[model samples]
Every structure is written in structure tokens, then in C-alpha cells.
Target: MKAILRTMGGWSQRAPTCCAVVMKHAVLWCAAMLFAALIPVVHAVAADTSLTPEASAAKMAAEHLMTAKIEWRGPSSSPKPLAGKRIAIVSCCEAADGAARASRAMVEAGKTLGWQVNVLDGRGDPQEQNKALNSAIDAKYDGIVLEFVDTTTVSDGVARALKAKIPLITLGTLRNTPDTIPDVSWDYAKHGEALANYMIWKSNGNVNALILLNTDLYVTRNGQWVGTKNVLTDPKKCKDCKVTVKEWPMANIDTQPGSIATAALQANPKINWGWCFDACMSRVSRALIASGLSSKMRGAGFDCNAESLQLIKDGQVEAVCAADPREWDAYAVIDNLNRLMQGQPTVNQGIPVRLFDKTNISTLSDYEMSHGWQGGYDFRAAYRKLWGMQK
Candidate 1:
């Protein structure tokens, strides 16, 4: 397991000096060399014998990471009822389909409950997010849903909202610290582990991987990276697996994943698998094909976006651990808000994360992708009943 040297809340406070940054890279390079040296020894031992019982069990466990099971279990107490309440949804950015779909879900869910819904777009700007929060507070909305906005950047705004006694629920804001606000998100670590395990299984324990990481979304991306490293480096899990990383700022991810991934593949010809924390990085498909590595490399990542699914269909990517922002997470946010409004203790709404590959891609209709992916379960009626909207 990788030991976490320090903990970072949503954002990094200070940039490292040039010397410190260089020293860090030098240390990482040394570690990578040591890891690479051991790969051949591990491969030789594995080739001599069939998988031990323990190793076989580990592989089976990895395969099972593909699907998630969720149960509501009902809230502790009845909800306070929100028939005429006003709710505001502040989105980090709608440019990304995930964020836009989630915002729409929250609005529709609120309206379904006969509540007034207001949506504010942050457009990926921290200042704009803060302004939206302030506007929501000034207007005295009964509750607020913050989607994918960095809480660290809007601490003052969150503080003000808390002072106003407006219950705050967040989706995709990565601060695990104890706060008055509640965050409704998936187990990001598990998502990463699933991706790593899928790659390991597909490669038959002989895998070399390059992970495209987004540092701006460090809270979640870092967890995924750590999970990937933990599985890839464990001798029991996959002794022959070797892994490396390339970091990109989230702002540049839209245009850089392809070039950066292409360059990494060029430098490391042995790499057979590519991984990303977000499906958006699947854009690297064109670059991988252009560089002549498309046939040799398989990719996996999180999110069930249209593009990622298309890549799976085209055979450029192998798998994706899917999440439906509109149907899964957005509903959780609304359910949590309802719990808060009614004086019920919030429950962890475990959103289902399913693995989508060629075998199952046919099950998805075009409508599902054009909107956000919806899970197998119909949760609207159950949630409405919990909120006292239905008998």
C-alpha cells in the first residue's frame, strides 16, 4: 500500500519551490527504477506455476469489482415535507455533460416535489461559484445543492450559507472533513480500484500501465491513483504489473489528454494498458491509434459518458466503471436534502457503479447516452414516498 505522507483538502495552498519540485521528481524517478527492476523477476516466477489459491482468489475479487449493489434501507424518521420550499442548485460547470445532466436532474426532482428550483451555473469559475452561493444565501433559499464546485475556493460562501441556517448538500465536491454540509458522492477509491482490477484481469497479470491523472481534481483523482497503485503494485494482486503516471491540470484536460498520452506511449513502448480517472480522457483514442499503439493498448476509466461508450464500441477502450450523475447521484442529493429538511439523519445513498464493456454496451439505448445513464432500479417512487410526496 502507498503511504500517504500528507493530507490535502480540496485544493493545494502553496506551490512548491523549483528546487523542492525537482527533488520530488528525482525521488519518484528512483522509486520507478526500483519498481521496474523487480518486474522481470515477478514475471519469471509467475510463468513457472499456475496461480496459487490466494492469487486466484485475488483475481476473482478484482473481477467482482465491476458492479455495485445499493439499498435505501429507509430514513430514520419522516421528512419535514418540502411542498413549497425553494431550492437552488449551483453547478461548477455545464460544459461537461456530467455536470449539466446532474443539474437538470436536481431541478426536475425538486419540481416533482412541488418545490421551486433555481439553478446557477458556475461555468468552472471559482469566483462565479462564490457569487452563485451568495445569491442563493441572499435570496434565502430553503436549501442549496452544490455540484462539482471546489468547496475550498468557496469556504467563505459555504460559511455564510451555514450561518444563514440553509442546509447545504454537495455532489462531487471533495472535502471529506467533518463539516455541517453533507456530500453525496460515490466511493471514488473503489471506482479507481475497479478500473485497475479490470485492467489487471484483461492483461492476465502481465500489465504495464500509464495513468492520466488530473491534479486539479486531486481529492477524487488522487484516491483513484492510490487505489490503482495499491492493486497494481501488490505482489499478491498482480506481481508482474508495473505502473507509471502523468499528471495534467483539469483545465487543460480537454485538449491535452491525447497529446500527453501519445507522448507517454512513445516514451514507454512496453506499456500495454492506459487508465484515466475520468472517461473524458478517452479522447486519447485518436492519439493512441495515430501512434500505432491502438491495437496493442486497452483503456479503462470511470463515468459512462457518450464518448467513453462510443470508444468501447469502437474497441479503442476496453471498459468503464460507470456512474449516472443524473439518475444516481442527483437523486441522492435530493434525498439527502429532503432528509435534512425533515429532521431525519442522512443515510449514505450507495450509488450503483456498473462496469460497461462490449458485452453489455448493446443494452444501453441511444436515449440513455443523450441524456445521462440511468441505473437498473427505478428510485423516484421510493424517494417520493420517503419524502411524504406519496402515500
Candidate 2:
């Protein structure tokens, strides 16, 4: 019995003295040892958050050192004159406020260039978008611009346009696939990282973040979350940060963001920061206040829409990553398409993204803030001059 006990490793220390009890106790000891062996495996699957306070501070310092300013890189010069060209503007949904504005901007740019522009509203239906593309192809439009339409969903339409040798450009949709043309949008991952970095620094690297995601917008939405998680979970970037993600169905954002955010905050009272992928969903300001966490928690997100900018100015939101989905994005798309028409290699027109906070919100005029802080730049005039619309 003593030799068998020695073979049991540390289980021998807990062995029963009586022979009758020995068998029962040995079975329980074996189960306990098996469970203990699995604990490390479970922990390894989770995010590693075991950094010393000193190490965390050092990591944050490195993050700060790497921070840089955002710059706008619009077209340096417009492509050779695009006079007498016929352009088709296909809008994903005119009911979508951002898409409407972008469509208008594209039409205005086409007018400035003496081009006949045809506007097609997809009405948020893929079939309608397909019809619009087919119509544009039949009409022999010189170029086509798509606003806020998922390229993958319209892959067949895109293939038809490509086969027709029509130059196509997409705006406000993140498409890295080869089937699509040049996509004019901000770097969503970088935008998300900026928001996360702000929260981490503001909380002194001790942040429990609740990320609100819109899973409907798959690529851009997930890309933003990836950036946020990468910084929040990395021990070298934020040692004391913890992240919990909750995805809201796309249809629920307009009406349910407040309620969903309230429930999430109530369930996880330790959350010190709330990060949203789109500023439109950041309408949870009232929910944050109602929970009495207004003073304790800070929120940041993308888009500098009117509500979000006001929240930032009023101290309800900590930061907003601003991009001009209304105008600049459309201009970039037109500029690139023009380049492609002129036999020049199309380039990714770098749209600028700025983080707006209380400190700088007051400095912006009302018009600028209302336009999502995009009024500060004059990309329209610059592009117009490049296209030779102005001297």
C-alpha cells in the first residue's frame, strides 16, 4: 500500500489511514488532480492581463511616444479634364442621411466638371442596386460611383460593370477585395485604436471597457473592434485594461442603443469606458447619465455627427473620431475615378480623421461642429482647382 501511495505523487499526502476509506478517497483525489491540471489550460485561452503596475506605466509611455497627428491627403492635382463625361451616382439608400449627403456631393462635383450625372437611389435594396448598375451599364455611363453599398453584396453588378470597362469607385464602404474598385473611407482600425488609446490614457491604463459593436457592417465594424481589442488586451499596451464586447443588431441601433447600453452598464457596473464603432450609436448619452455613471465613465466613438459633437462639447462623450462621409469621401471617389479615366494609376485618396474632444470642440465654429468637424478643411476647392474648375 505504501509503494502504491508513492506512485500517486502528492495524492499520497491525503490518503486515508483505513483500508476501506482508501479507495473512496483515492478516487476523489484523482478527480481533484485532473481539475487542477485543466486550470492552466483555461487561463491560457483567456486574454493575458498579468502585468505589474510599473510595467503598465512603461507600456503606456511607449504608446504615447508612438502617437502622431492626423493629416488630410486630398488630390494634389485633378486628372486631365473630364469634360463631357457621363457619370452615374448609385446611392445605397437615400433615406440614410450620410448617403444622401454623399450623393449630393458627387452630383455637385460632376456638375462642376461639365459632366452629366445620373442619380440612382438603391433604397437599401440589393436588387434595386443591381438594377441601377445594369441600367448604368446599358446607358454607357463613362464612370460610376457607389455610396455606402457593400461591394460583396453587389459583386455580380460590379463584375458586369468591370466587364463593360467602366471605371468604378466606392465611397463610405470598406472593401479590400479584388472584385471592387478603389474604396474611399477612413482607416477604421486606426480610428478605433485612437478611441481606445484615449480611454486608456484618460483612465491611467486602468480601464474596463464595454465595446458596443454593430455586427451588421461586418468588415468596417469588426475592423474597428479588432483595433480596440488589440490595444486593450495587449499587456504591453494596457496592462490594467479589460474588455467586454456586446454586438447590437444593425436594425436596432437607431432605437435600441440607449436601452441596450443601459442594460449592459447595469450588468457590468465596473465598466469605466464605453466604445462604439459608429457615432450614430453613441446616442446612449442619456443612458449613461441615467445610470449615474456619467461622472465615472467616459465614452468615445467614430464619426463627429451633430449629436456626438454636442455630447463631446457637453462632456457626455470623451472623444469622437471625425471623418467626412458627407463630402470629402465622395470627392475622393470622384477624384480617383477621374484619375482612372485619364489613364493614370488610381491611388487611395487619404481622407483625414481627427479626434474631437471638449478642449477643441469649443474652438470649432457651429457650422464646423455640425458638419462633423470637417468644415476646417477645404478639400472641395482644392479638388475643384485640381480638376481645373477654378484658377
lDDT of 1 by residue, 1-391 (tens): 1323343211233644654575589899999999999999889678534654444554566556544454554343345466898999888777666677787888888887788888898866778888999999999999998888767778878889878888888887656333657888666676677776767666667779877776555355656667778888888888888988787655565668778878877777788877774434567776777777787667876677777777787787545544544566787788789888777666877576666777667767786655545765666776777666664
Clash list (residue pairs), candidate 1: 80-342
Model 2 Cα lDDT, one tens digit per residue, 1-391:
6776557645646653464376678889999999999999879544234544534454354344233344556656656676899999888767545566677778887787787887898866777887888788888999988777777767788888889889888876776445447777777776677667767666667889877776545445656777777778888777778988777654455656677677877787787777774444456776667667677567776666666777777777445443444577777777888887887777767776656667566756777666655545677777877877775
Which TM-score value belongs to model 1? 0.77
RMSD of each: 21.4, 18.6
Error of 2 at 297 (Å): 4.2
Cα lDDT over the full model 1: 0.71
Model 2 residue 50 distance off true place after TM-score fit, in angstroms: 20
Model 2 ranges off by over 4 Å = 1-72, 92-100, 116-140, 286-297, 322-326
